[model samples]
Target: MSGRPVVEVIDPGIQSTVQAWPGRTGLLAQGYFPSGPMDHLCFRASNVLVGNPPGAPALEIDKIAMSVAFLEDTQIALAGPEGIHARLNDVPVPIWETVRVRPGDVLRTANPGRPGYRLYLAVRGGLDVFEALGSAATSLITGIGGVEGRSLLRGDVLSALPRDPVSARRFPEALRPRFTTEWELEILAGPRSAPDFLTDQDWSELVSLPWRVDLNSDRVGTRLHPHRFRWANGGSIVTGGHPSNVLDDAYPVGGLLANGDVLTILGMDGNTSGGFAVIATVPHCALWKVGQVRPGRDTIRFRAVTYDEATALNRQVDFTIDPGRVQVL
Candidate 1:
């Protein structure tokens, strides 16, 4: 270790704290769900900018503002909305790119102009926090991960690990993600909902109609405007004991499931086991794109893509950001 204290949280803004990959298998084994961040793309982007390896722990912030002060000089980057601004000793800093800051400088966000929910802050060598299972993620639902599996509060401090000098030196020019109004999420139909409950037209409408995001949405799952659909059965499925599916049937991360009273679009932080009817799943490649949409903005539309296309797109993205560029700092 470099003997440098990682960055510490001065004010855990509106809802800011450290998160890493996630604890999935163990959580599911214990009947707990895996709840992480809403936008993994932005999270990974910040990590890459700060020269941290993929899956390294980073900070996740909600609408509320947060202030972080470094214990030592460090290189860092911010990804997500411009509303979540950063200041070094009160000097304004840009988002989506790398910048160096000295100790005692504070970073924070301003009143947001756009409809964004989360911000990710990453530093050189990643943030140092106790890992649960294999990640540092905070699963609020089960009260696991992070500082006791809860949101960061005031007066909380975080430490950092030493980074390789070579990684720190490879800092690239600041790059910001293109936030736009044109947001289209791709979905794959699967796991069938009651088999008979959904008609061809209902499934068609799901992929065709524009559905607005409900205001009561969060990291766990997003609820969309309801649409009429029929179900063959109204009973619950038995929860089984399988390596992956404890809920009896196998389902994808972004699966669209219907419970007794709600229609939810599962996101990255969805439950590991559920008896809800599964209609579809959003492709991993297109998951981050949904973060750009604001609540009550307008009904969002889903486009259906073949499994081959989804796989191809994901592979292309991985190729675009080569791990070789990640130098040890």
Candidate 2:
């Protein structure tokens, strides 16, 4: 846990390597949104597999390819899209599972496909990056968090927290998530704008029509194609401060809102305060699923569920390692 080890970046991936903690929490305080992995559930699952606590600093890679060599032995996990080809000493490795490596091993990753955007990499003890505003998560737009609020680049040597030799074990294959399935997102009506902003037709279109993810999507907000409705209160709204549920405060991750006449799906890195009307809030459990969605190929459809049903489904999911079978290398 002391005297960090060096992790050299031989190649910077398409996107920067970002990290973040839980972020600040208080009444009437505007906290910086920690935009890390698009699929945070998988990110957290990787951390827990390697015995790291939730919210630990992990590497978040976007489309750009990356190549690095470790200075010491380490345990790591690669999760997210299919393009990421993580390797040890030039040997291919699998995603969504933990792998072991010896000192001087080289780990390289490539883009999953054209238009690819993100990848999540977690080390045994997590990366030892600086924490600002109570989080290590990077905010690219605001230029805050992660290596001076910027993306990781070539020749950057990141420090790693000391590892626990005893906890260095291979992750079971059963624990990995299937990356090749279509993603479906569930949403609830927004606290403020949902009631007064979107017309009935807009709401119906959101639930019934299939919306394609536009190439313009990013960590800030996902721009979707035009649906069949107009704003009940027009496209613009007065600026104000609100809470997670309130449109006047700041929007939270999974907040579905319209931006500049186009339907945008806001992620964790969305602005804290805005005047735009909030349409819906993607539940916590569904946030990761939404993040895994690929552009053009993915379609988002809303399904209504009762609170009890949502809770039951969330509880049914297993979030721990099975300790049953070993992952084939």
lDDT of 1 by residue, 178-204 (tens): 554445788887766324556677677
Tell me the deviation in Å of residue 65 in model 2.
3.0
Which stretches of model 1 miss by more than 4 angstroms? Answer: 1-4, 22-32, 82-84, 164-177, 193-195, 231-251, 296-298, 323-329
**lDDT for each residue of candidate 2 in 177-273, tens digit (9 for 90 to 100):** 5554345677778744434767777677778877788877777877788654565654323343221122445776677776545677787677766
lDDT of each: 0.66, 0.66
- Using alpha carbons, what is the TM-score of model 2? 0.83
Instruction: Provide the clashing-pair count of each candidate structure.
Output: 14, 16
